[model samples]
Target chain A: MKGSANRRVLPGYGLSLGYTIFYLCVIVLIPLAGIFIKTAGMGWADFWHTIWNARVIAAYKVSFLTALAAAGINAVFGLLVAWVLVRYKFPGKSFIDSLVDLPFALPTAVAGVSLTALYAQNGWIGSKLEPLGIKVAYTPLGITIALVFIGLPFVVRTVQPVLQDLEKDTEEAAVMLGAYRFRTFRKIVLPEIAPALLTGFALAFARGIGEYGSVVFISGNMPMKTEIAPLLIMTKLEQYEYAGATAIALVMLVISFIALLIINLLQARMNKRTISA
Target chain B: MAGAVTAHLSEEASVRPQHINESVLVRIVLITIALAFLTLVVIFPLLTVFIEGLKKGWDVYTASLRDADALSALKLTLIVSLIAVPLNTFFGIMAAWAITKFKFRGRNVLITLIDLPFAVSPVISGLIFVLMFGAQGFYGPWLDDHNIQIIFALPGIVLATVFVTFPFVARELIPLMESQGVQEEEAAVVLGAKGLKLFWLVTLPNIKWGLLYGIILCNARAMGEFGAVSVVSGHIRGETNTLPLHIEILYNEYQFSASFAVSSLLVLLAVLTLAVKKFVEWRGSKWQSK
Candidate 1:
């Protein structure tokens, strides 16, 4: 068995492996290293000065707060959408089901402009809300709406497969013990899908944090108000502040990496739990 | 007696137990909330793209699309997708083959690395290359010495698109190829099939649906890519702008009708992407059922 581990059962392994690694290095690894390599040349004071400024701090707050709100909204609605799709039958279900993926398919730039069109003061939805003294376009609220559009699919897609696999037998047994439908759902079903919901929430949050195309138009790019962390990087680059841009980008990259690592660990734990259960 | 009657009645009324059934009010409430939310978020903006695009009439819409800058942007987008998608596809196939077909050290690490681009912000995806190839970048001097331009040029756009889309095909194929196992390929090899022939006859047929699924997604992202391309593109009006960038320029210029018209085109692409995706998933499931 030990020797079998080294034995080749198929051909082209060397060719494919070499090509894959070579391509990965050229396309992804080397470019990513550029971020670190550029940032490494900066002194600690310069790096901190670039990243810890009022404008940069504001951008991070805007990025996190909007992303957090969007993900939160998505978690609730996404779970409902998944549950309704899986548990109930209705007209237009198929259409709605397909539409759930629109965010993934639609160009972020198109979504950004379309949403801006809809929520601007004289635009469709925004016209209806303006009398109430609310402004959506070119504000943080607009940014959240765009992020919501971007992140909506993440939560629903992640929760759907898990919700579908849930056993009806458990709910049936719970009901047979005289529990009501709501109680049965809360006590029996919610626990099962909790891990999936969390994963979805995290994914949506991470995506929203980095989202640029969809948020930029609606955000108005007001430096202290609606500016996002990614936009700041772009602003710096445009200003030829390569070190400053690299510093902000490096910090954002590290945070994104940490978030992704957490997600991987969470998914692994969830898979193990499912197998054991 | 009551329990038996309830059970009998429930059997006729529905397939599940009586107590598990939500009241009609609850079900209606839940479905209403879900549909309303979808309409507000997904449906309205979609409709708006078409409505505003044609707000100035068909001639205006047509003129805007036929605008030289618009056409060129469309051409550039197609060209970029044409190059980026296939290279990534080739890489995807090779990566999936290596990861799934053989037992190797660092396999998990390789897979995770493939996924790294997805986690990175699209802005950062562009910045990495700028840091590599921009005038102030590591390779800047060498490129300048050679009189070559990359960061604000076609090469940079292609590289950024490639980076952003690196994982799409591989991500789709790995789990699929893993599930299909290596037995079929091994059997084909034993029967004297080798190299390209074995892959064409055995592995390719088995993974065709998955591969198509991957390519469709990769192509969609490649063509629709905005952030990464924007960063590298100098936004030369008729020279370097892609469709999305063109739309941005038009919108920023207050050419609302024209901007929406151009967006209408990408929206059409998005719709096509979804339809093709649905068709492939249906076909893949049907093929699996066989």
Candidate 2:
């Protein structure tokens, strides 16, 4: 009945698309807009003063640094795990593969409490390490451990597929030419997977910065010391500092959005390059 | 002649490309490090939950779980997941159909917005709802006039859960649907199938595994969600406390055994989630290979 130019073969486009937009607007878009609108109502000085306070700045530092440390740790171990899983065959390999996703499947609260118990001075691992004057629980180190638990799968999962699809011909050629194993890997394999690694690092970093439930129990919420950015928002909310919470949330939201945007752009570029190459 | 053949074989073996792979020692070392790290970081903590939960023995474990407040929190968690999972599932299916089945502008932007919640802090996820419906929120006065409660109540809990889980189902289905393409659906349509028939017969079967996979993830998060639900829950004991929040309550009360006992239930759920996820993935891959 309609013009052929605009005609569609299948139906429900309007019904489905309309529902999608409406739901997106109500459930996500409008609520997020509330954050911006609430912050916009705060004047410039108040806004600056709220987010720029010493405590908030300290929280930002802890959050960023711990998340960075956690992401860094995950990048190393995650790469190792991904490399092993792809390159080797061993006993219980599939089981170990599934275990990498435990953090994602496990509740954050459970992870937080369990990690705390494991790391507390009197707890299992903590007791052993206590003799060496190492305290993990209730410290930034504990926070990094929790974030590592949460962000571990991101790096492995992201890099696993890329590694799987990597062509072995180049590596074989390099070895045939007498290149050493390490040198061949460093030159051939690393470049092929660098984008994926960077994407995983960015993903893990973004997740670490925004992490909440897992970090809280281990963090001990020691204000300037152990408190994370998300916990600060929770504290402000509890104290009925709606404007302050809004401002902090706004800042976090923006940073996370920008990080996600960059990752998406990077992935798109990688996908295009992969298709072309 | 036999001695000469043996010497030739030995020489060829010596000239083989043994440098391509890591030495046996190196492989063993790398695997050992990966396993040791996973043991300390993942497996130990997972085991700790159960061990600590039962430290006070089975009697205490069962007694803590049978506590009235614990049961209520469990009920609330189920209720919230019941409402939130299906709603998000419906939204997920619709959004995936739209984004994948048709060519449209701003598709990438739409996908990112759906994923927005993942990048946002869970605390902020809850705070967003509070800002919209709290006592000082934009519609605060209106909700008050109607004797309505969104923040610090059931509605607020559900909203936060929904927001936190908004992307799970859609994220699973979009790539799946995109990869499957529209050829099958078009063929069904051309053969006189229409609307619901087309979907039920064609689309549903194709996407069911993915949809179920999404629901599994969404349900796990919905039930286990703490930070977002914590913000709006108000921690009203047996009234507003979900299971995760209840665990926090018991933990704060220094009822260490009781808290871990409650946590063990979610641990069980998490284990179950992983098991089912493995199944779905297996089935999906099998189907794809067909």
TM-score of each: 0.95, 0.95
lDDT of 1 by residue, A1-277 (tens): 1223543778899999999999999999999998888889999999999999899999999999999999999999999998777766678876788888889878999999999999999999999999999999999999999999998888888878777777778888887798888888899989898888888888888888999999999999999999999999999889999999999998898888888888888888889878898
Model 2 C-alpha lDDT per residue in residues A195-268, reported as the tens digit of each score: 88888888989989988989999999998999999999999999999999999999999999888988898799
User: Each candidate's lDDT (Cα)?
Assistant: 0.87, 0.87
Fnat per predicted structure, each in turn:
0.70, 0.66
Task: Give the C-alpha miss distance for residue A263 in model 2, angstroms.
Answer: 0.7
Stretches of candidate 1 off by over 4 Å are A1-7, B1-18
Output the number of the lDDT-best candidate: 2
Which residue pairs come into collision in candidate 2? none
iRMSD computed for candidate 1: 9.5
lDDT score of residue B257 within candidate 1: 96
